[model samples]
Target: MNQSATRLNTEELNLALNLLRAGELVGIPTETVYGLAADASQPEAVAKIFAAKGRPADHPVIVHIAGVEQLAAWAQNIPDEAYLLAQHFWPGPLTLILERQAHVSDAVTGGQNTVGLRAPAHPITQQLLQHFGGGLAAPSANQFGHVSPTTAAHVRGEFSEEVLQLVLDGGACDVGVESTIVSLVGDKPKLLRPGGVSREAIEAVLGDSLEHHTNQYTAKQRVSGLLDSHYAPRTTLITGQAARLQECIAEKLAQNQKVVLICQEINTKLDIEQFLMPSSPQAYAQQIYATLRQLDLQRFDTLFLALPPNTTEWLAIHDRLARAAHHRY
Candidate 1:
């Protein structure tokens, strides 16, 4: 592992801060995934993130802060639910969408009245935010619509040093997926995106059922990771149940196409290359992106991932896989 991979080095932290102050992009680690970060107050700095990733100007990014105390600087008319969710899930993988304050840049909110905010639990990034004392508008540290980076090495591979100079290596992400996004701007809190935080858990805290609004393209307010074909890999990805995926694998192999499979079980021996994934949802989320990146690098004709159980616990995983897949078998 690199010296800064899992630990915060003072020199590296300072360099990242300096880069952000100078309106440059920095790859900052978060508990969810690595993020391409810039000072949120600087629209020009934030624009570089979109330019480098080829992200759409209309698609909004999340602004990361140190803790709940800084929330008021970016959002106005904050609801009690926002505070409640932040109290319970801040410094973790929950992103709250609220109405933007007047000073909040349109670049951060994608020309909308709403802005997404998260307080990441990564230690190195926490330190960076604390020292910088400002919000960093960051999206996943990878090309737009690609699998997000879960490690510093992955971030480095995504962009040239000129584009993204310093990647503060905080090692592999704990919650390999992005943050759970809940839009509090509406009369009812809507679950905009299923992610690291479970919907059930968030509902339990709110004491009301959340309105399911994942993948709502018609929504006037945009949030991160809500697109139809996001988090995809370069290689063609086909996902389905184990039996169905196996059938597809055989069909592809028969056509003389190279195929790989990642699943929870193996009932029979087949000629296809295979990798076993964790059966548990938490473990699965942590490894899914890295596994996809690994398989994507092998140049396979197709990548087959057996779908896990369709349950509340696996909702986030299913949502991500659905968007990542090129086709469903």
Candidate 2:
């Protein structure tokens, strides 16, 4: 049985901040997704985040601040490139990995010498940070390795009230995905994750080409949401071009296998389990996770998704599905 978490108002938001001050976790809304947040200063509070989400100790979480004013305290040797990117994209969906400050915790950085930081673009979250006056180490508010929740209801569906003390309902996330993470700890910036901030947008500001990380995880590459088999549903998912996916579905039908088709363009007349998605990439990104969650609740044994176009606009969407299907880069 799932216990519904409370939706916070102004009064309740203050109460939620108090809970964080007491070293408790709260599900706070960001433009990306709901995040399980705790005071970044407290190692114990950060540890609870890993405990609640069942997140691996080796994988790092992002530290969210109110602004760049807190950068020197959280990160060291801040690069000129970091400042340029932050000026262009902070208070939006972008994460920067930089050389860890002397005081930053190993628990937050996954025992590494670097940390991920972002100033969220949500009003409630910004207000909370303002009142709290510190950083919050947060990851997506759901079981680790599962599809990320886009709304307060999605969070309630995932965990009971006891597990998540309070939820600040800022409604559904506008971006509906995680932030784009760039690692400035290297000689040049490398794209760790493709997300709301397009690579093209970042490169245009830098006046230099950016290196795209393949996400081949080593022990040292302890980045958030970079595991090979991540963002998966319970059922197997195979994704490719529309024609190829259709042929595969036909082959499965011949074997009398239980399958469901998820696509934007497909044969609607066919008598089979299907979920139609929006053709636009941004709209599709907004609903993709919710679609997978709802479809996974049904009796289908396999989920077949027709691939989106291979373009920069579709990069974030493709990155997500490829990981969901456990496709290596």
TM-score of each: 0.97, 0.93
Against the true structure, candidate 1 has what lDDT? 0.90
Model 2 TM-score is 0.93
lDDT for model 2: 0.84
Residues 1-329, model 1: lDDT tens digits: 22245546778877888899999999988888899999999999999999999999989999999999999998999999999999999989999999999999989989999899999988888888999999999899999999999998999999999898888878888889999999998789999898999999999999999888766565556788888899999999999888777677777888999888888876467767788989899999999999999999998989888898999999999999999999997
Per-candidate RMSD, Å = 1.7, 3.6
Q: Pick the candidate with the highest lDDT.
A: 1
Candidate 1 C-alpha error for residue 216, in Å? 2.7
List where candidate 1 sits over 4 angstroms from the true fold.
Answer: 1-7
Per-residue lDDT of model 2, residues 1-329, tens digit only: 01123234678877988999999998888888889999999999999999988998988999999988878889989999888888899888999999998888998999999999999988888888878888999899889888898888788887788877787888878787789988898677888889999999999999988888757453246688778777888777888877667667788888898998888866675667777899888888888988888888887878888887788899988888988994321
